[model samples]
Target: MAMPPNSVVPTTEHTTTTTTTSSKPMEVPVKPHHDARSPSFLRLGLYPITLKFEDVVYKVKIEGKGTCCGGEVSMKEKTILNGVTGKVSPGELLAMLGPSGSGKTTLLTALGGRLKGKLSGKITYNSRPFCGSMKRRTGFVTQDDVLYAHLTVTETLLFTAMLRLPNSISQDEKVEHVEQVIAELGLTRCKNSMIGGPLFRGISGGEKKRVSIGQEMLINPSLLLLDEPTSGLDSTTAQRILTTIKRLASGGRTVVTTIHQPSSRLYHMFDKLVLLSEGSPIYYGPASTALEYFSSVGYGTSITVNPADLLLDLANGIAPDVMQEHEQGETTEKDQKLVRQKLHTAYETNISTRLKADLCGLDVSNHINQAKEVATRNHVSSEQWCTSWCHQFHVLLLRGVRERRFEPFNRLRIFQVISVAILGGLLWWHTPTSHIEDRVAMIFFFSVFWGFYPLYNAVFTFPQERRMLIKERSSGMYRLSSYFLARTIGDLPLELALPTAFTFILYWMGGLKADPATFVLSLLVVLYNVLVAQSLGLAIGAILMDVKQATTLASVTTLVFLIAGGYYVKQIPPFIVWLKYLSYSYYCYKLLLGVQYNENDLYECSKGVHCHVVDFPAVKSVGLTNLTVDLLIMAMMLVGYRLVAYMALQKVQ
Candidate 1:
């Protein structure tokens, strides 16, 4: 029978090898059934990634504050990963083990093609240099489960499938794929349940982790890289997750993950292990032989103790000898250094040779040639985008609507809008046409209220979604334009709903106008005003990815717009008169006043006396006579602000 691509077929018996040292020859453990043979390169309709890195080094710069005399700031260079070398073949699950700050996550990020630093080395997928195409073939599960809390499990996976799966796959196939993944991850029971967050309780932590895994699996990636997949879960949950990963590897894919102190049972699931300390590798080999190698080097632990814990303790310089001496007040920093040095020296002298020999046998060049030939035969490039622009927009639109509908803040905002509208109506209740001051007060209040509410709500847009956006965009899942356009269009219903309610209540209750056309026009102007305000807020949020800073900036800008809105001071000086033209509120207020009191409308006294004042002077005071011009200007402001927001988002990324 022909073997599947990257699938290993095990034999009944396994052979063992030993390394010879000066003291004695140490017996190596028998290879596990899963790792007994190398996987063959055959076309199985899935590209298997063979990742290899040699002498990978990454450095970052740290900037400190300047001295009192304004001297140059202190700059320091820190190495995150040094001389890290390893190879993970298809059908293998490699676990990177180390203590805190040991550069395990850093190395994982580098291999995922998400790291930005001064990196020097060779990183290849099936012997071809890593490129944007390989990034799509790889799935990266971050430490935290960053998901839409309001979306159900099925919806979440469906959205990912729609955006990440190639367009050649039909909608039916996408749905089938999502269902398959759901069933594979054992999430069928909670398929319709929401993935809730702090405010709501939905699925269990383990279920959430599974959902995260299922999301990446939707695209059927060749290589999966996870950072701390079992970080916050219990032992049972972590074991289940690791088991799922191992099963995935057995299906002819490569899996790599970084884990903190894992239980013995969990550690045994990994096919290979890379032990790191302070950004340097101490040992790299088959997971079953790790303890044997350590024992041969005089660092064996008690049979009852977990080998993973022993490895961590040794790597962190907290071995039994060092810990015992420290408890007895007889250990120093130098003594701890000596213990680490001894382990490193032994691994280099005795185990490195065998590790290199095994890596050399991977035949990465052959795997690369096979993959290229298969991809060419299928007329598909791994780099092709999964979804088209229209498809991406459609998926994003649905997700944005779902998220906004369930957001507690949005519901609260609706209530607040109704309350504020009712209060404003009561405060300026059914005023007479002769009361010019009351009319002006109502119009000014309307302008300020709508502007402030939308601006406040919009400031949270980009700041809240920044991390998710960065992750998705970095993976080349979709273009920035598609996201921006979808988000802007997605928010239209909610954005217009509240303002429409406010206008309807405030317009009739305050006795502004009884004409149907005037009411509709006033409503349209208010909605446009809200959109302009929200666009400014989006731009501010994108420019400053901090909620507090964006809020503060928005408040100040709103204040300036309100002052120049031609409400407080009708006769403005030449120097500051131009500011009114830039304010959306100015044009919105003008349009509202014009629509209510047209050129022929009269403001007569109510005591059966015809006054000389035919209409309120509000239109001419702010130099806005033509209602069409004012409406057009408001429209322009809407588009201009949205354009600026789009540009800001692109620039920031």
Candidate 2:
């Protein structure tokens, strides 16, 4: 059977809101619940089951000391939110309401299975806690918009959609779906607009919020959780968002969010409003009853007051109305205490049960079972590994290539190549009068210098792209490997383009008196060096994750590799000699000399005399062979770096 939209299963069962009165309100008795037994990992390591949390209590310790008490720094960690409980059923919008610092965002992250704290309660999804299959099935949108600033709005969504959407859908279908979401979020005007800094701008704050919502929606999660969806927005915009949320919930999607100071007009839209103060539940129920519940306990409705403000007032402390009533003998202080006890008791009995009943709505177990069954039935064999990898890599590779074509620096490579040609031609006219060793030094120096620009570009490029990737990766759109591989492969041609052009210009102009095969071999070695440098850039970018740091590290490392590469110094210290072996410069220099110069040429150089005669130092075949070996070694290093990056990215969560 086809699943319902947002996965809500229809039922005739209904729940009614509860009410209580206080003129010295009667307190309900409290009862302890039986703890859920932990499951055995051995017998059901991969068995699929839904995650459930019943009677969940989360506490955050706040630090402070009373002014009257000791003025010492007290290790008192007050609870920010306590006895908080809710259920995220498929196809529902469950909004969690609280004022600022009420631990709403904390609860949102915890529900996403990503919070760092001690949780005293049972949280089971797919029969697993946080690390099981439920994580894959859920989509979390944080308070901050972690988008790639440089990518266009459409490009951002499309790239993520391509990775998250199953291959069962056609390209056209996928595009249509993404477009629909964009339109739904009202980002059509900025659809093709870039997602970056001042140079790249698009979409309004409200539209961006919707797009963020869309990003998670792309995964088609059964339950959607948003933190402060209307934050930093105008009252009008906030209402529109609330309207959309209401519609989303009405349309069978479960939407839960923590909103701060929602407008009175917007307050009526919430299906459920959970009130929190000093880390305790003050009220939890429908919006209509919120005012009633407070008024029944002597709060009574206030004229022209924001409902959120009223809730905060009572949660923090009662006002002078209570003291005035007490002095008038209308209500005693004992009665006030009795009212608070009754309200707390009602919340524990009525509100907690309603949330528990709603917990049954989520079907995390079913989804996990579906994923496992799909995996087993498909039986993706070892032979399909190559095909699977290619499929995964292609999605990112195509995006990277497209991004490059439109990149501002696209024409810079051509400019670099032309500049190299012009400069090398100028040097050709004054051709060095030194020995063959002098010419060898000139060729090596220029090649190393030529490699610098691309390395610098690679290093800086990833830092900018990482902001975009982090947002995409967090949304569960694609594997990190796809991003790293696609970027490396997509930019490979651009990386090699300038260096290859430089090699041709300098080789012919410098007139190295070498055969065509030797010229080609030398060119290959230099190009491989450029590739290795690019990989080095990627590794540094991944480690630092900062633009300034990565750029600095790349520049310094490039210089070290060039100097210690064995081109300048004839001999290095025994302790530092290993640096030569570690440097790509050493390989490129040794292999180039072996390819271009003969053994006799080296001997003549040692004799301290310039030699220009043809075959003066007969060239050997050994040097030509070393070119292939050196290039292979450089290729291995590049691959090894990429593998390390891939491993590191997988552990980012």
Candidate 3:
């Protein structure tokens, strides 16, 4: 047999010239624009590609009351794809051809290893069991375009490319890959353009469809699956996409997709067509033989109609109401019955048995069973030590920065800081004689109020990002750590800006005591406030994962903490006294009080001396010790809350 394309290419003269010449770097030759599905250039040291699925069956049960009548309705277990068994060899395209409800998409999910619900199936790629790591080898393009609304196509591709490909790959190489994928899918013309908003002005529907496919191809997945790739498209566009798909299969990558209705213009693109009806297989073979099998059983359907439409009509069967309501000389039950019988006999006797025999011969069944046993017995690595943990922190930081850079709402926090500082300074200006007691209270109040800014920002912004992040992560787009790390890095600059600016202005303007050390200490406390608040917001966001829920929880928690935070109301009832210990704000308050009053206890104000003044209980303790403790608690809160949120987020997913 000729060697499969999955095997490595030999180092021939052409290969050596391409691989070694730096002066003219080997560029993966771009295929002609019209040849949409050309194979990528063969590379050295690539892994083998293999696929296996065992008795895959996806079921959906409906048991809900009717919306209008409120009558109990129970749709018994409906098998979308019954006993679906097929092996996709490397470099093949399995086209699922069926009616609207034939469970085409459902079967695609099972085979793609993404569906959840009584999935009694085994899916393996390259002899490795399909799991989280295994998913890295597979890519799925859903029907909808999942592009970020605002980012340009290149930027969107770059963002995903950064986290997925290793740093060793030069930026030029990455861009080359993205461009290659674009060219491969015939997206070169709009490569640098903006992925349009809901209006979709920039690119055509066919271009958007190709972009969706390109996002998955960027990963160089061995198995690519799509749902309704040609849906809601013109026949010309549909045929164009299918042609690309056929080319991908020819390149030695297994491609599977469900298409609703394919015109004869696109029918030849399919390598194998699996027809389904009411959760059962009615036909599974070459597309050319489909009409022949039907006609032999007395259906005698003409090829004048679109093959996709004709097959669907035969499989779906005619409705009783339609047959009864029809006028004379319309489609009748006898005609439909004959067509159905033809399809049924063809599948029952020939196709199903052939498929079963094919499946039995390529039995990786034992390997799959053994892998499942090992997976069940294996202990989960410390959940605390998640893969790319530090990477997540980096992603989170970057994410924060991106939010400020991208979303206009974050600028409001800067406004709040400026407004608060100016307002506090004006209040101080009104009281020129800075009584030590009043100044102490002023500093404490400023520190306490500033914490709320980050809290509000995190609570509001995190929920939105959470949706996008979860969707991306679930699809295996990027590592969770990279996401977390980006958010953390991105937000740091913004997080530091408001507090740093406000604290510097207010520390000098509101003068009770002024020294280099004291100013620095006060600034530190203010920064801590930001971190603490942000951490709380993250924790709440992870716990709730809903905007309304996060908002409500953050509001209530802040209110409860403010009341119990030892500012205005302190002496709690015996029953609620323990809340003080659990409340994060309580610890923060203790640290602030320590910073404010530590100097007051040691210094006595006199007319002749530059001594610290002790005028009120608020000024009793103000020292480096209190400030240090306060800073420590805030750091703890920031890290502690984030860790807690991470744990809660896992459960949420």
Q: Pick the candidate with the highest lDDT.
A: 1
TM-score of 3: 0.75
Ranking by lDDT, best first? 1, 3, 2
Give lDDT per model, in order. Answer: 0.78, 0.62, 0.63
Q: In model 1, which runs have C-alpha deviations exceeding 4 angstroms? A: 1-4, 8-44, 296-298, 301-304, 327-330, 342-362, 373-379, 571-579, 598-621, 626-636, 651-653
Worst 10 residues of 2 by lDDT: 35-44
lDDT of 1 by residue, 519-552 (tens): 8978877887898888888888888889999999
Residue 196, candidate 1: alpha-carbon lDDT:
82
The local distance difference test score of model 3 is 0.63
- The predicted structure with the larger TM-score, 1 or 2, is 1
**RMSD in Å for model 3:** 8.1
Backbone N/Cα/C clashes per model: 0, 27, 36
Error of 1 at 26 (Å): 62
Residue 578 Cα positional deviation in candidate 3, in Å, after optimal superposition: 2.6
TM-score of 1: 0.87
TM-score ranking from best to worst? 1, 3, 2
| Whole-model lDDT, model 2 | 0.62
